[model samples]
Target: TNTTKELTYSEAMYLCGYLNGAKKENRDLTITEREIRRRRSAVLKRVQRIGIDTTDWGAVNAFFLDVRIAGKKFRELDGEELLLLIPKLESILKKKEDGGY
Candidate 1:
């Protein structure tokens, strides 16, 4: 059975708004965002595998503060900010491995 039901005016408007919002959201993310997310994910995975204590607020805050990242929270960082953060995170991880934490 392939019966079709036409949408009401309000339903149509709601659908349109939902679709437009989705499109706008996708359009808002440029290539830089994608790249930054990719890099950030990789860095986080590596850090986790290396057993860095990401849950340690003091350490994480110190790292972000030292690197001059405006936000103390990693999830709040934007794409360009993540780009700057990844290398600093790696360096911090390296220092930790070398008993510098």
Candidate 2:
């Protein structure tokens, strides 16, 4: 049997914050911003529950969390815009968690 749990919006939010902080605070962090986003998306895609579309929602949540955590505010971006940001966020999150960053 397979068991799965969807990430809470807050969990995703925490991850996004973690990713952003890791990048900003860890200059010695070797991972590229591009790679970080990619890894983050991979994690989100792994989610089996919650959100209408895990991949899309993950990306949007990531971008919003990053922007908000960074203390930079901007106009609302459409889903497509957020989708475009997933890979970047994924890579960052992965590297940081893996200790590559």
Candidate 3:
């Protein structure tokens, strides 16, 4: 059986944050939990990069937790999770560039 899993909005946002942080920090494909928390600011940068204004950090934080990416807070995700998230983030960025966002 072939089943496709769809990511929720919060999950997508979390992945976007991770991707932006990784790119900004020039780090390896996988990062530690401490790094993820430290790099939460990257999420705002990424949203701005996509031409979206982020004046609501509270909402962003809530969304991150709602998605359960790092449980209660941004933390280290497994390498396997990062691998899956990277492609999704790339796709979102491409879509934004294509004016699909």
Candidate 4:
């Protein structure tokens, strides 16, 4: 019956082409996203060690918005945004430890 119907040659070729391209998507993105999250977590942990209340969501959001070039929320940040934010956070951390903040 219907289940036994064979795909036409062009239909089969199209499906194969779609699968070949789709299968390779997200592999690089997933790795980059994981690395970004890891670096973000490490920066936050260092902030916590300096006595900033990382638990308070509003303050965290405010800090991110203030320091971020794009003013994006924490979760909305991608690698490019995070790359820009990390250096600023690290600078503040260093200044705090040096009694500058």
Candidate 5:
């Protein structure tokens, strides 16, 4: 069976802090998570081209965790962290385009 739980406003606010560089509980996935997922995919596609197995979540999470300053898992990164991470990811892509990856 499939079920879902809705978020409370307080939880949304907490996600605000959590995403904006403050520590807080990650109650659920939100729009920012989707954006993070997209960014991760872009990186991993390049990673795969460099011959790393994208199927291994361990390596994937490690790469993302290293990209941002926080979050044990990539999914836990919030908006502020995302802002920091985007440039880094783009830079990596740019360098790789020049055959550095």
Candidate 6:
């Protein structure tokens, strides 16, 4: 339950660079950091709305959070980490739900 794989700092930097490039390469498009953050917030809210009862939902949401921050071109993510992390997230969510630490 403790072996959740997270993106390394280098990987995260690479992803952010790619995202910046993508935004700049758009000829007829404009994007802002505010827009990205707003989208990320929306995704976070949707994940919470899944009710925290199912392991799968928690796993999906955690992965989704990584995706949001990593700028969506994360080729290294294999989705298997979600299978490993769901139980831990479930417990955390349960504690948060029940007013426990």
Number of the top TM-score candidate: 4
- lDDT leaderboard ranking: 4, 1, 5, 3, 2, 6
Candidate 6 displacement at residue 5 in angstroms:
53
Error of 6 at 36 (Å): 23
Models 1 onward score TM values of 0.46, 0.27, 0.34, 0.60, 0.42, 0.27
> lDDT winner among the candidates?
4
**How much lDDT does candidate 1 score?**
0.64
> Which ranges in model 1 have alpha carbons more than 4 Å from their true place?
1-33, 50-70
Candidate 5's displacement at residue 26, Å, is 16
Which prediction has more favorable TM-score, 4 or 6?
A: 4
Better of 2 and 5 by lDDT: 5
Per-prediction CA RMSD (Å): 6.7, 21.3, 19.9, 7.0, 11.3, 17.8
In model 6, where do residues sit more than 4 Å from their true spots? 1-76
> Candidate 3, which segments miss by more than 4 Å at Cα?
1-73
| Model 5 misplaced stretches (Cα beyond 4 Å) | 1-54, 67-71
Put down candidate 3 lDDT per residue, 4-43, tens digits, no spaces: 2477777677677786774535444345645554444454
Candidate 4 lDDT over 1-101, as tens digits, reads 14325878776766676776734355577777789988778767765766768999776677667643347567777767666666776787788889998
- Model 2 agreement with the true structure over 1-101: per-residue lDDT tens digits: 13224667776666676867854446445444445555445434532222225546555445455653222221344334446545555566577668785
The candidate, 3 or 4, that scores higher on lDDT is 4
Which pairs, if any, clash in model 6? Answer: none
In order, candidate lDDTs are 0.64, 0.48, 0.52, 0.70, 0.62, 0.47
Tell me the lDDT of model 4 at 71. Answer: 78
CA lDDT of 87 in candidate 3?
Answer: 49
